[model samples]
Target: MKTLTLLMTMSLLLAFVWERVDMVRLGYRIERLKSDKVRLERERDELRVKVSSLTSPARIAKVATEKLGMVPPRQDQVVVVRLEPEAPSPTSLAEFEIKLAKHDVSRKVR
Candidate 1:
């Protein structure tokens, strides 16, 4: 009976220590994840700032004129093309108009 009680006590202590070790390991993993999350968030913020700077109008215009040789159209060089009216038949224009009306109605409803 004494041997059995000793064995039970040892088993309980072992189980408790195993649980504590598992908790410590899980806590370490959680800390690592939090550190990684903070690093990634900082990187994301830096990238967002970089993107905004690159997409600024002055930068875009400068790059277009310098690197791509793109220039603004002069008033005399610009020619406007007028599209002919589509037929009343079920054409793409009519379909687009129907979709637009549906969108407008949805917007109004909202």
Candidate 2:
């Protein structure tokens, strides 16, 4: 009876120690993940700032003029075009009006 009780006590002690070890390991993992999250967020912010700077109109214009030798178009060289749908021809309009909401029915109404 004494040996059985001692065995149970040792088993319980071992289980408690294993649980405490696992908890400590999990705490370390959580800290590592938190640090990684912060580092990645900071990196993302830096990349966002870089992207905004790279895409800024001023930077783009400067690079275009300096690197690619591009120049702004003169007012005379620039033309604005407006697109409008073509109007139906008079003959087609007359044909459509002649057809005037006609639909086929199976039988004539009384």
Candidate 3:
């Protein structure tokens, strides 16, 4: 009976020690993850600032003029095409087919 009691005690002690070791390992992992999170957040903020600077209109315009050698179009050089609304044609399937055939024939002639 004494031997059995000693064995049980030793087993409990070993289990307690193992639990403590596991807890310590988990604590270290948590600390490392926290530090990684902070570093990543800082990097994200830096990238956001970089993106804002890169996307600014002034920067875009400077790059366009300096690197791409592009110029704004003059008003006189722009031509606007105005489209007039066409009258509604066939509503039935047969009528639509006939209209399409006629349009195809006209296009072939042109």
lDDT of 2 by residue, 1-89 (tens): 99999999999999999999999999999999999999999999999999999999999999998887666755555555544336766
Per-residue lDDT tens digits of candidate 1, residues 26-100? Answer: 999999999999999999999999999999999999988888766675555555554445666555443332111
lDDT by residue (tens digit), candidate 3, 1-110 = 99999999999999999999999999999999999999999999999999999999999999888887655655554555544336654653322211111122222221
TM-score of each: 0.69, 0.70, 0.70
Candidate 1 Cα deviation (angstroms), residue 101: 30
Clashes of each: 0, 0, 0
* Better model by lDDT: candidate 1 vs candidate 3: 1
lDDT of 2 at 8: 100
Which residue runs does candidate 1 get wrong by more than 4 Å? 82-110
